[model samples]
Target: MNHGHDLNRRDFLKISSLFLAGSAAISSQVGQALSSTNTAFAKDDREEVVHSFCEHCFWRCGIAAHVRNGKIYKITGSEHHPLSNGKLCPRGTGGIGQIYDPDRLAHPIIRERKGGKSSLRKASWDEAITYTAEKLYQIKEKYGPEAIAMLHHGYGYTFFKEMFKAFGVNKFAKPSYDFCCGPRLQGYTMTYGHGTGTPEGIDMMNSKYLLFFGTHYGENMHNTAVQEISEGIRRGLKIVVFDPRFSTLAGKAEKWLPIKPGTDIAMMQALMNVLISEELYDKKFVAENTVGFDELWAEIQHMTPEKAATITDIPADEIREIARTFASYAPAAAVHPGRRTQWYADGTQRVRAIAILNALTGNYKMPGGVVKYEKFKLPKPEAHPHPHFKKDVWSKYPFFVQTKPENSITSHEVVQQTLEKEVRAWFVYGVNVPETITLGRKTAIEAMQKLDFMVAVDTLPMEVTGYADIVLPECTYLERYDDLDGGRPYRTPFVSLRQPVVEPMFDSKPGNEIARMMAEKLELHGVFEDSVETYLDKRLNKVGSSLEEVKKTGVLVGEPTNLYRKPGEKLTFKTPSGKIELASAQLKSAGFDAVPKYIKHPEPPQGYYRILTGRKPMLTFGRTANNRFLNELPTARENEIWVNPRIAQKHALSHGEYVHLKNQAGIVSEFPIKVKVTERIREDSVYMVHGYGHYYKKLKWAYKKGASHNQLISKADIDQSTGAVGFQNNFVTFIKEA
Candidate 1:
């Protein structure tokens, strides 16, 4: 309930409603048990229920598509599925808009150069595939197979990756790491020796004390986490959050520390200083399970709470109190490893601090701490041959590990380097790389422009599609039979299926079919299954279930078992020293800092503020930004700049006044946006929801309607440990209309 600065009378009123609403919701929704299971597939005469997994967001909640008169009328989360637990967030509920979107590409398109201008022309699937295959082969012959680089996203991209690998090429790109949770993944693996399988491995429901830094559960809309956190709150769970903005998680916290940006490491260091100096850490667990504790203790000698307070801009007393509260709860307390660690240049070390804090608390393998994800193993495709190629940009970072052995390069780095002709061909699937990657939309467009050939596979006409030489139309998830969605670790392990509720619309084909067709054309058919259905059946049969049972039940739940290490076991780690490294010997050996340390980020230049971006519940980055039902929501459509009232008054800006934004690098926004001058944000920072300011003319609902944070970001600072982009480093000044 604390404000960093005084709010103007009008600004106070505007934010009062937000604060009140958040307060009321927190009081009511927190600690409420999850809803009772209700099968969305009850026998109904008017509608038929078809089971599938939602592609709305990466959460992949199980969905029951309601087919009425051969068209999908509604989507409901499957009650039987553990992830969904009979509920869907706003994005999942608005999935119908995506399927029936008017802006959807109806058929394959070929961008033809006429009068030195590119124009899209409709082409037959046969003609499109033939042309695409011919161009890829030509690129392979002329510049070698290594010249072909692919950027893909999600489980559905398996075919695209395999097909390229079958072509003896292994260069791949995904923004998931460099732009998202690469730091958390690397830090967790180094500390725990293996990545927390998909969906994350936090046991929030059992935790009594939860410490969150920069992650928003309700707004992020990870169904299981939201449900669990709400239920935990009802159980009288204590929560603490550190963020500049009053996020949903912050509003619910017992204490909300508006810590200065890029000072998370200082706060973490102070927490460790208290635990180690006070001898409050679990001594038995530390002695039996960890390595390099002496080194860690020695490193923390200078990291006093007062010292951290100076750097973090938080009170030393509160820092001490929080650290005490965290250790008081012991094994049941957890420091939630945040998902988006692509903040400052030292983000990897920041997450490493989080990992170490969890380790010091002896939280792993305990009821309320970090738990292992139990996964159901499925059949892996026959290993495809891949030729050794030039390392992609991700390989430069010491901490960046190959998520898979075949591909280790950073796609964004490659995209940026493509301007210098490092890569010749690009196969973009499922992701909008140009918008998601750092260094702005212009850099992405220029890289695409420089490519020898570009093929975009998508269901909509996005900005990337505008620059592609060929556009392959894909059917929406509702109209496709993708592989099984289940088999990952979760509260309960389960397998969900994605089946077509209706036939493919227009001339668009399923992603698997597109992959198969490409493979057949390239005479690499052995790399793919005969059909997507066959692939699903093979995976389902491993668990004594088939495609038919999944269609009937919506999901197949696995029996619960103890997946975590037991009460008494020899503890081991995968690090170079072979134990949980309190002070990483590997990092020290690699010449990086052996322990987490505060690294100050550059302050904003005069007359500019740091631009901070985050998610909105209705929008999932760029994918659902154009969803009609979702985008029509006021919060989803409006990309207002959240400027502090003091800053606004100084700049002669008023509420609702539209202004252009120019970043420190001299890149200006493509459009003017409304401003919300309030005390919700810090004076030194401006906040905006990402995934706006669309330039694609065909997306009438989203084009030029709001400001794009990406356009204002022209510079990218690479994290030395992870090769991930420190996306929040840029600063921008507002430009009022004349």
Candidate 2:
């Protein structure tokens, strides 16, 4: 539809064709049932659905495929799904590429040397499993169970962690715990009591005011929030976006504040001062619901308008005006808790500051705000507690738990660094580490190099797979049945399962098959049968359904509760406070500043502009770099830096100028750059789209097209109380190469 400001008159014809194609596809894909009944099938195609959950990105959306004989024809969002509403993102629709990727490992390959670069060769399933398990056993016997580590990415890999624990390996990690969202969870649980992975859900459509700090839900590629936010925009909600870059969502926002990266805390505190000084804050809610106000007030008193002005580049008057707006809107005004918090060392504190604003505004547990959601109930095969490991490899690492006796290890802190000393081998399940690791690619590479044994379970040849002793090619989500985790709660109440849409295109196997094989090899067949179909059936029975039922319905949905509101009654948080916290009492005791504070980020030197990393909606972090549909989506090519024309002229840099961007890391990449001088962005910083300049020659569309910001990042981390890396915190000099 509406192209809005992104429209160009001459480009209209091309846009029309693209829009029509996309719309027609969406229409057919969304209403697959209707289209299926009308189509005539040739004997060349016998369509059958293999139910599965999507692993395209982390959302794990459920799907039931339409297959013809042995080949999958297409994949659509499960109509019976409670969460997705039968809608899939572009990535989900592009499932075919992953299934039929040409470079997919045909069979397991063992590197000739123990510590060596991996090359593909024929490997029998038996030999691969036996050799890998034997090596793990050897490492356990020699260096102790702590010597072996497992780093998992998606929630599905929790099963592998279970396998590790069953095998007496306790040194396991998932990026979600430490590097991605750990600090924010720590901040929230330390303050309020529970942390949600995304916010159970954001009530954007009904909210009056929507405020964001570092979150960009629209471009973040989580479709649930993006879809809802779009609805909110249609309803004309007061949407305010606060981030350094002018993102797609920010461009659509009523107000966009292009602040300096990492200066959020100062602005938030300034707003708090305004709220309290003018009595705009909800006094009743604060008095009755919160504790430690005196301490918080004491700090806010000193973090005055003048001091906040100096700390945050935002002028004092603007901060006061925004604070008035925040409190003025009150109750239903929601602050979005975004995905990653491990960007800056101070990330936890930053999110805490944002949460504090929520408390002051009395938005907690209210409709049209951050509602306290009731957990969804589903029947699943019972999973008991993990068995005691030989030793706790994560014993040295400290993690913040929401409840009593809670202890979980931080992924960023000690889990990774201690890999060589405390851990001998690693089992990587469904995670791409090289691209995900911040500023530690070399260190990660070295650690992976030292491993006695390792295995990477994925579809394509990811960067981490290069070092794997065994690379098990996994079937795409379209090909196998997964556990109920995909539609576990938010998506649907009925346990949706993934089945085969086609016999795997290559010699690839589903992750479950690999798991089952490992289980049998380790003689844990009784406790853990690694068959995904068997597990799918087991979970199906719990939901009062079976594999046959899943095949018929595609997905199962519970009765819609009028709205996806907290439902029936308010849900209790997993945090110790029993409510939301602004200033955490638990954090105060943990040797970290209890209150979220403003700390000036390590600035990039003058002349060297800081480059912030972001992605287009069509692609994900280096995942869809191969999708031809998306590859040709016409992104800003070259290392196109968004520079204000004033600065461009001052530097004698014209539009599409070739330039050299050098950071403190001594890394440089060329740019056939387009100079975007616009009011939407800041002149001090240059911005470029991520996933460009794909170094891998195999990735035809993306390879060598532009520069990778990740390559240029200096190895400094933020004060990760916030659990994130401020890659935008680095400074660099940009020169017109002429």
Candidate whose lDDT is highest: 1
The Cα RMSD of model 2 versus the native structure comes to 8.7
TM for every model, in the order presented, reads 0.91, 0.86
Lowest summed lDDT across 10 adjacent residues in model 2 is found at 10-19
What stretches of model 1 exceed 4 Å from their correct place? Answer: 1-46, 114-117, 386-394, 402-407, 561-565
Instruction: Identify the runs in model 2 with alpha carbons over 4 angstroms from their true place.
Output: 1-43, 46-52, 68-70, 114-120, 379-397, 400-408, 411-420, 486-494, 559-579, 636-639, 657-660, 670-679, 718-726, 735-738
For 111-164, candidate 1 gives per-residue lDDT tens digits of 666665555667888889999999999999898887888887766787788788
Clashes of 2: 41
Q: Which residue pairs in candidate 1 collide?
A: 31-233, 31-234, 394-410, 486-495
lDDT of each: 0.77, 0.61
lDDT of 2 by residue, 607-691 (tens): 6667766666667765576666555556623346677667777777777666766676665653334455655557677777665
